[model samples]
Target: MILPCFLFTSLFMVKLSQRAWNNVIIVSMLALIMLFNLSSNFLNDDSDAPAFSTLIPQGLLISTIEFSNAKVERVGQGWRIESKLSVSKDLQGLLDVWQSVEVSPFEENLQWGDSQPKVTVWFIGQAEPIEYYFLILADKTLVKLGQQTYQLVNVNYQTLIPTE
Candidate 1:
């Protein structure tokens, strides 16, 4: 729509005055270039999205965290967040965020089934003894849990829990 309009307007201007044709063409070309550049910039900006992280004191007791050997399974309708960890007191207030939370002498894997329609787990926050899972959408929109929002930052993935 816009391309055609630009071309038409430039052509009409050129038809009105041969002397002004070159100037109109230049202006029209510049306008089209600017429009393309702006649109591409906006599209690229949304590609990776964002995740959040915060620093806390060491030795703050947190449960163990791990991802399933399987890639994050988007089964049924939503993506699953599966992991095993030791239960900790710090997680008491955040239990609602997990699809499943369990403790066992042996590794007990848990899953947050069907997270697709609403959220995508993008980042996981971890400290000396605590671990957290951050979920977001493909567009980098932070997934909200309780009252907190997540954002992505540069961090060590080996130390932090994995996102599929």
Candidate 2:
């Protein structure tokens, strides 16, 4: 609607050659595309928080290749690491690093920055897997459900390796 009015005004104000009009059209189209692209970045980052279901009532299969590079699973007795040894206090403490994993929403910017090796956890009965991502150099924690949305979760890296 406004385009026609603006075009009409531009046409009366300036008389240009056919080639110039074509160039103008191309430039305007490019500008619109650029505007949409820029706005989409904001739209994606401003999306509502992910809706993470309640904690799995059964158990969880926690796996990661990051700091500890440990693979843990809930066994008949207790947590098992690397599918062999039982979860010791040290190992248990390492596992506790992710215990505060929550699916709460984020109000501010939640942009997915530089990717890192994520700690993937499989909650029994959950359709989506919770993947925790963070930079070892940085202190923030980012999480994503499956492949859809990502959010900055409230978590920090703590040294669970007890001094022996």
The best candidate by lDDT is 2
Per-residue lDDT for 57-154 in model 2, tens only?
12555533223455666666456566333434455665565554444443444556655555556765567665555433364544444444434354
Cα-based lDDT for every prediction = 0.39, 0.53
Name the weakest run of 10 consecutive residues (lDDT summed) in model 2. Answer: 49-58
lDDT of 1 by residue, 77-112 (tens): 334434453323222333222322221121223333
Q: Count the backbone clashes (under 3 Å) in each candidate.
A: 12, 0
Model 2 residue 2 distance off true place after TM-score fit, in angstroms = 56
Error of 2 at 6 (Å): 68
Candidate 2, which segments miss by more than 4 Å at Cα?
1-50, 53-68, 83-89, 102-115, 135-139, 146-154, 158-164
lDDT of 1: 0.39
Q: Estimate each model's TM-score.
A: 0.25, 0.39
lDDT of residue 17 for candidate 1: 66
